[model samples]
Target chain A: MDTKTDLLSHHISQQFNNELEELRNNLLSMGGQVEKQVSDAIEALINADSEGAISVCEKDTDINAMELTIDEECSRILARRQPAASDLRLVLACTKASTDLERIGDEAAKIARFAISLTEQGEAPKGYIEARHIGNHVRQMVQDALNAFARFDADLALAVAKEDKSVDREYKSATRELVTYMMEDPRSITRVLNIMWVLRSLERIGDHARNIAEYVIYLVKGKDVRHIGIKRIQAEVFDQ
Target chain B: MDTKTDLLSHHISQQFNNELEELRNNLLSMGGQVEKQVSDAIEALINADSEGAISVCEKDTDINAMELTIDEECSRILARRQPAASDLRLVLACTKASTDLERIGDEAAKIARFAISLTEQGEAPKGYIEARHIGNHVRQMVQDALNAFARFDADLALAVAKEDKSVDREYKSATRELVTYMMEDPRSITRVLNIMWVLRSLERIGDHARNIAEYVIYLVKGKDVRHIGIKRIQAEVFDQ
Candidate 1:
C-alpha cells in the first residue's frame, strides 16, 4: 500500500509519526470538548436551564485555549518536521479542522446566551422543539464530520455536507413558522426573534461542521471540494 | 536593530525575502478584491441595484480562487523556506488572513443575494438607510484592517477591533428598530426580515474584519488575541 493509504500510518521516523499522531489525538480531544459544549448548550436551551447555559458560555474559554494549542502544534510541526505529501495534508487538515471546531463552539455559546435571555424574559419557550431537533441533527453532523476526519473517509464527509443542506432547510422552515407566530401574535416578536437567532446560530454550526468535512475531503483526496457543488465534488473525488 | 524591526527587510537569503514579499503582495491583492466585493455588495443593496448585486455574487468565485492560491503559497513557503520567527508568523497570519478575507467575500455575496431578493420582492426598502450607515462603517473597518495587516501596525489593528464593538451595537439597534416596525405593521415582517438578515451579514463582515486585524496583531507582536476582550487584548498586545 502507498504511504497515503493510511495517511498517518508511516513516516520517515517513528518520532515524526508520533508527533502527527499526537496532533491528531489532540485535535480529536478538542473536537470532543466542543461537541459536549454544543450538546450541553442545546440541552440548556431546550430545558430552560439558565445556569447550565451560563456554564456553557463560561467554558468557551477552554475551547478557545484548545484551539490555540492545536494551532501551535500545527505550526510547531511545520517548522520542526517540514513534512511533505500526505503528512503535509494531514497537518493542514488539522489546522483547518481546529478553526472550524472553535467556531462551532462559538455558535453553541451563542445559543446558550439566547437561552439565558429566554429565561430572563420569562417567556414560555416558543421554538424549543425545533431547536432540539435541529440541535441534535447538527450535533450528529459534528460527530460524523470528526469521525470522517479521524478515519480519512471522504465519502462520509460528503454525507455530512449533504446533511447540512437538510439542516439549512429545517432552519428556514422553523424560521418561517416563528415569523408567522410573531405576525399572528405581534407580542411574541421579542421571544420569537431570540429563537430565530438561536436557529441561525445552529445553522451556522452546521455550516462549520460541513466545513470540517470539506477539509477531510481535501486532506484525503488532495482536492478542494469547497464552493463546488456536491455532485461535482463526488465526481472529482470518486468518479474519476 | 533586530531582524523583526522590519520583518521583510533581511532574511538568510534574498530569494526567501522575495518569496515572502510576493506572498504578502498576493494577500493584499486578495484583500483588496474582498474589500471591493463588500463595498459593491453594500452599494447594490442600498441602491436596489439587482444587476450589480448579481455581478457581485457571480464574482465570488474569483475571491475563492484567490484564497486557494494564497493558501497554496503558504504551504509552499512552509515546505520550502521553513520560515522562522517573524517570517513564520507572517506565513501563519497570511494563511489565516486569507481564510477570513474569503469569508468576508462570502458574507458580501450573501448580502448581494439578499439585495437581489429585495428587488425581486419589490418592497420599498425598509432598512436601506440603516444598512447604508452600518455597511459603510463595516467596510471602512475591513479596509483599515487590511491596512493594518499590510503595515503590521498593532495599534491600528486594535482600533479595528474597537470599531467592531460599535458595529455590533449598531446591528443590535437596527435589529430592534426592525422588530418595532414588524410589530407596528405585521405585513412588513417579510421585508424587514430580509433587511435584518442583511444587517446580520454586515455585522458578520465586521467581525471578520476584526478577526483579520487580530491576526495582524499576532503577526506583529507574536501574540494570540482572539476570544480575549478588547481591553484585555490591548493590554496583552500593547500595555505590557
Candidate 2:
C-alpha cells in the first residue's frame, strides 16, 4: 500500500480500537448500574422498602440511555470505518452485550416493581430464607459474569456458566417452598407469588449475564461454548 | 480506485450479501422451530402430553446447533468483508437476532420441561386457561416480529412493539389468578405455580421478539426507537 493509504488504514484501526474501548467502558458502567439495581432490589424486597424500589425503577432510564448511546456509537463506527475480522467481531459483540446489559437492567426493574408491591402488601412468609439465598446466588452469578466480560477472562466465563445450575436448583427449591406457603395461607399467596416472579426474574438476569460471558468468550477466543457441557468446554479450552 | 480493485470489491460485496441472506434464512428457520416448540410446549401442558414435551427438549439440540452455525457465519462475514453503513447494520442486527432467537428457544424448552413435569403430575387447574391465553398472545407476537423482520417493515415492527403491552397485561392477570388459585387450594398450588413459570418464560420470549423488532426499526429507519414512546418513534419517522 502507498504511504497515505497505509497511514489511513492505521488511523482507522486505532480509531476503531478506541471506539471498542469506549464500548467496553460503557458496558462495564451499565453492568455496574444493573448489578446495583439487582442488589438494591433484593435489599428492598427483603426489607420491604418501597422508596428503594421506586429509586430502582427511576434509575432504569440511565441504563436505557447508556444502551442507546453504545448502540449508536457502534453503528457509527461500523458505517464510517468498515472494520474487518477481529475488529468487526468487537463491534458486533458490543451491540450484543449492550442488548444483554439492557435486559439485565429490565430484570432489575422487574424486581424493583415486585418489591414495591410486596412493600405495599405488608408481610412475607415466615421462615422463608430460601428466597434470599436464591437471590444472592443469582446476584453473585450476575456479578461474576460481568466481571468475566469486563476482563475477557474465559475461565471466569466458564465458571459463570457452571454456576447457573446452582441458580436453577435454588429457584426450584424456592418454587416448592412458595407453593407450600400459598397452599397454607390464602391471603399471603398473592404477595408470595409476586416474590416468586421476582426470584424468577433475578434468575433470568443471571442467564442473560451468562450470555454476555459467552459473547466475551467468542470475542476473545472465537469459541462458541454455548449449549455444550462444561466438561466439553474445559476439554476444548485445554486442547486449544 | 483501479478497475481490478473495483471489481474485487464488487465481488466481495456480493459474497457478503449472500452470506447475510443465508444468515437471515437460518435465523428464520430457527424462529420457526422455536415457534413450534412454544406452541407444542403449551399443548403438552394443556393436554398432558409427555411425549410432546420430550420432543421439545430433544429438539433444543437442533435449535442450538442452528444458532452456532449462524453465529460462526456472521462472524466470518464480518471478518472477511468489512461491510459498512447499512450492510454493517444488517450483519450486527442478524447477530443480535440470532442470540434473541436462541434465548427464545431456551424459554420454549423450559416451558416444555414444565409441561413434562405437569403431565407427570396428572392435571393442572384453571390457571391452564390463563396459560393458553398467554401462550397465544406471545406466540403471535413472535410470529409478527419475525414477519416484520423479514419484510424490514418498520410499521409492522412498531405494531409488534405495541402488542408487547398486551402480553405484559395478560401476564399480570395470569399472575393474579394463579395467586388466587394457590390461595383457594394448596393442593393445586404446585401445578399452578409451574404453569405460572411457563407463562413467565413465554412473556420473556415475547420481550425478546420485541427487542428484535426494535432492532429492525433501527436497521431500516436508522432510528433508535427503544425506550422512547411510540409517538416519538412515529414523529421521528416522519421527521426523517
Candidate 3:
C-alpha cells in the first residue's frame, strides 16, 4: 500500500514537470518573437522601410495570441496542480514575462506608427542619425535583457540594467537634437515631433528591459529589488 | 484518533486563512496608497503645486517598503502552506496586484517630473485644458479599477476597460490641441511639448488601469481574457 501511494505521487510529479517544461518553451518562443519585432521596427524606421514596419504590426497578432495561450496555461497549472516552491515561482515568472513581452509588442507597434508618419512626411532631416543611434542602443538593451532571461544569467541581467543609463543619456541627446531641428524651421516641427515620439518609445523600451532585469534578479535571489536603489540590489544580491 | 486528526486539520486551515487575510489587507493598503499618489500627482500638475508633487515623491519610499514586505509574506505562504485552488489564485493575484501598484507609483513619479517641468516653463498656453481633461479621465479610470479589484467585481472591471477608450479619445484631443499650439507659435513648442508628455503619461496610467482590470476578470472568471476584445470579455463574464 505504501509503494502504491509513492508511485501515485511520482506520477503526479512527472506530469507537473512536463507541463512546466512546455510552459517554459512557449514563453521562450514568445520572447523570441517580440525581440525580432523590436529590431525590425528599429530597422524600418532607420531605413525608411514602411513595409518592414507594417510587417511588424501584422506579426503582433501572433504575439498577442501566444501571450493569451501562455496566460491560460499558467492559470491552468495553478488551478490544477497547485504548484509550490520553485515550480510556483516558474509559473509566476511566466505570467510576468508574458506581460512584459506583450508590452514590447506594443512598443514595436508604436515604432511602426512613427514609421508610417515619417513615410507620409516624405523624408526626415539630417538629425535622423541621432534617432537611429538611440534606437540601436535600445534594441541592443532589449536583446540582452531577453538573453539574460533565457539563460537565467544574473550577470547578463546586471549588464542590461547598467546599459539603461547610457540609453537614457543617448535619449537626452536625441531629444536635444530634435528640439533644435524643430526650433530651426517650424515646418520641421511636425516630422520632428513624430521622431521625438519614436525616441520616447525606444527609451520606454529600454525601461522595460530594465524591468526584465529586475525580474531576473528576483528569480535568482528570491529578492524584490525593484523600486529599491540598484546599488542596494547589487550589494544584496552579489556582495552577499 | 480521527477526531484529533480533524482538529489538527482545522488548526492548519485557520492558520492558512490568517495568512491569506494578511495578504488581502496588504494589497488593499498598497492599492489605496497608490491611488492617492496618482490623484495627488495629477492635482499637483493642474494646480502647479511642486510641494504636492514632492510630498508624493517622499511617500514613494513607504510604498516601496510595503511592496517588499508583501512580496516576502506571499513567498513565505506559498513555501510553507502549499495552498490549492482558490487560495493559490488569491496569493498569485496578490503578487501581481502588488506589482501593478509599484508601477502605478512609478507613473505617479513621472507625473511629478512633468509637473516640475511645467512649473519651470512659467505658463502653459490656453490649451492646458486638454491636458487637464485627459488627466481627470485617467485618474477616474484608475480609481474605478481599484474599486473593482477590492470587490472582485468583474462588472466593475469591465466598466474600467470601457472607460479606457474615452481616455484614449481624450489623449487624441490633447495631441491635436498641443500640435496646433506648437504650429501656431514655434516658440511655444517646448512648453507645448512638455504638456504633451504629461498627456502621454496620463494615457499610460490608463493603460496600467486596464491591466489591473484584466487581472480582475481573470480572477473572477478563471479565464484568460487578456488580448481579447473587452466587449467579448464583458459578454463572456456577464452574459449568463
Among all candidates shown, the one with the greatest lDDT: 1
What TM-score does each prediction get for chain A alone?
A: 0.96, 0.89, 0.90
Which digits, one per residue and each the tens of the lDDT, describe model 3 over residues B54-117? 8888888888888878887877887687665556666767777777788888878888887888
Global CA lDDT of candidate 3, please? 0.78
> What is candidate 2's lDDT per residue for A15-54, written digit by digit as tens?
6666767777787888888889888888888888899999
lDDT of 2 by residue, B129-185 (tens): 888888888889888888877777777888888888888898888787767667677
- What lDDT tens digits, residue by residue, belong to model 3 across residues A165-238? 88889888779878877877887777888888888888888888888887767766556677766688777568
Model 2 ranges with Cα > 4 A deviation: A1-14, A126-128, B1-13, B237-240
Clashes of 3: 0
Please list the C-alpha lDDT of all candidates, in the order they appear: 0.89, 0.77, 0.78
At residue A25, candidate 2 shows an lDDT of 78
What TM-score does the A-chain of candidate 1 achieve? Answer: 0.96
DockQ of each: 0.68, 0.58, 0.46
Distance from true location, Cα of B205 in model 2, Å: 2.4
Query: Which is the leading candidate under TM-score?
Result: 1
Those runs of model 3 whose alpha carbons end farther than 4 Å from true positions after fitting are A1-14, B1-12
DockQ of 3: 0.46
